[model samples]
Target: MNVFDIFWLFFMITALQPILRQRFLEAARQRMIAKIEKSRGSRVILLVHRQETMSLLGFPIVRYIDVNDSEQVIRAIHLTDKDVPIDLILHTPGGLVLAALQIARAVKRHPAKVTAFIPHYAMSGGTLIALAADEIVMDEHAVLGPVDPQLGQFPAASLVRVVREKPLDKVDDQTLIMADMAEKALRQMKANLSELLAGKYEPQRVEELAETLSQGRWTHDYPITFDEAQRLGLPVSKDMPTEIYQLMSLFPQPVRQQPSVEFLPTPRKGHEGGQGTGLFF
Candidate 1:
């Protein structure tokens, strides 16, 4: 080939490499999902969020649980037969409350069992969705966070409490209006969450659990580990499927100029007391 032709061919290959790599990864994810569904006899859906780079610009964009995600999940549930169970793999930091509620309600309404799998964490609105599942499977270290409603950057419960503690004349009109909205939002969240837990727990326990979750008792980012979740009466287990972890590895974080963390990808075995414990690190 001529020198110019060879140079152009190399440029084209370099340009298409990223696109081809992304396409291959997507195909691999689909195949893995199909394998899981076939082995478990359930419809599999994944709501995974990650900070990924744009194909050309390389600018990072963080994903969340949004309306589009809810729409797609609801549609998947609708397509499944009533008798078919669902396996929802969630790995997110949460998002819009309205979108989360839509997905949660849809999951609650499904005839067959709905299981939520968390290999890392599902916080805030993600936790709201997990509440609707018949069972929650998490890795031993994975966590779920609180679902207390936030008004702008502040928690709704805090806003209401602040207004109540302040003198009536000292509070501004705008603050009063915010407090009113906050109270309503808190009430609505409790009611909605209570409805989700209704059939699963006792009447009084339902209200108590709902209030605890919606009352801003803890910071929004506070992690509720498997042990704590169990103590709180949630239907949680540490029996995470290996395929779920494999699926998460496919959704890599955005590439950076310099990686923040690095480790050997393979497991290592350790011997203790002259016995091979098969310890991995």
Candidate 2:
């Protein structure tokens, strides 16, 4: 081959290398996920949320894209038999509101009773997903954070920006506009939290708790421990031992079987909280 043609061929190979590697890795991961789902005998699904990695890096990240893909997994499980019960294992730091809601809905819709096992942490959206389960099992150290929704940044920070930029005391038309926007943002966040909590708690109690927990920035909000989660009426149990991690390690990582696109959801616009905006599966 000519020198230029050889160089072009080399460039093409280099460009495709990462794509090929990613495809292979994804296929293997999906096969593992599917096998784990199937082997539980109870039509169980395993979802891990690693979004805290992005939170630490000061970037938004979608953590539960795989879990949201539960639609197809759920369908596949149902195809095997409609009567199989579902056991969902979750370990997440949480992600987008809508995405969590989607997974929660799928768990709720399954004909089997949904049981959630939390080995470590289920924060934010993760906690939301756990709420959908009939029973939530956690170890002594496991945690579930409050469902207080913040609009990307913390609500207090948004309020501070408005007040500092345009003193609320001597508000101009622009200041008034900024103040109104901030107020609306905070109000909407409060309302969303209230609504989400209402689904899990009595309306009066949820309203009371929402007022107390929705005050901080996203970074500063504290995570509730298993004890606190139980106090919040989350149907949490602490004595159960979790063997999922050990069991996962024993399973042979499955061979690459299909293209990832066949399994993953289509990518869409990014949301404020690093959550993927589109529904998957």
Candidate 3:
């Protein structure tokens, strides 16, 4: 080929490399999903969001659970046979409350068992969705967060508390209005959470759990570990499937020119060559 023709061919391959790589990764994920489904005899649905970078521009974009996500998940559930169980793999930092509620209600209504697997963290609305599952399987160090509602940038519970504690004259009119809305949001969240927890826990326990989760007892980003979750009477277990981890690896963060973290892909033991080695820092 002439020099110009060779250059054109090279440019085309370079431009298509990212697209081809993404397609290959998606196909790999599908194969892994099929393998997991076949082994467990259950429907697998993933609600994962990563801070992805825009192609070419390299601008970071954060994804959250939204109406679109809820629609897709509910549709997936509808397609599933009522007799088949479902395994939802969640890895998110939470999102819209309405969207989360929609997904949670769908999970609660399914006739067969539903299991939520958290390989990392699922906060806020993500935690709300987890509450609807019959069982929660978490990695040993995985965490969940409070399901408290938020009003704009502030927590709904906080807004209500400020209104209650502060003098009426001291609070601004806008603040007063937000506080009123906050109270309603809190009540709605508590009721919905209780509904999801109903039948799974005792009547009294359900009320207590709902209050604790929706009353803003913890910060929005507070992490609830497996032990803490169990102490709170959540149905959580540490039995993460290996394939789940494999599947997560396929959904990588957007690549940067230089990686921030790097490590050798080899397992290390305390002893090297069958002999204890001197400690090094």
Per-candidate TM equals 0.94, 0.56, 0.94
Choose 2 or 3, whichever is better by lDDT: 3
The TM-score ranking, best first, is: 3, 1, 2
- Residue-by-residue lDDT tens digits, candidate 2, 1-281: 99999999998998776567657756766665566566665656666644332212335444454444556545644564547767777776666666666676666666666778887777777776777776888878877775555554644445546677865677667655655666765565567556555555788887776665554434434768888866766678874532465433332222235643344444554575575656432
Residue-wise C-alpha lDDT for candidate 3, range 1-281, written one tens digit per residue: 99999999999998888889899999999999999999999999999999987775678999999999999999999999999999999999999999999999999999999999999999999999999999999998999999999988999999999999999999999999999999999999999999999999999999999999889999999999999999999999998998999899999999878999996655456554564344321
- The weakest ten consecutive residues by lDDT in model 1 span 272-281
Q: Per-candidate RMSD vs. true structure?
A: 2.7, 13.0, 3.7
List clash counts for every candidate, in order. 0, 0, 0
Per-residue lDDT value at 155 in model 3: 96
Q: Which tens-of-lDDT digit does each residue in 125-219 have in candidate 1?
A: 99999999999998889999999999999899889998999898999999899999999999999998998888989999999899888888998
Kindly indicate the candidate among 1 and 2 with the higher TM-score: 1
Provide the lDDT at 267 for model 3: 47
lDDT of 2: 0.62
Candidate 2 weakest ten by summed lDDT? 247-256
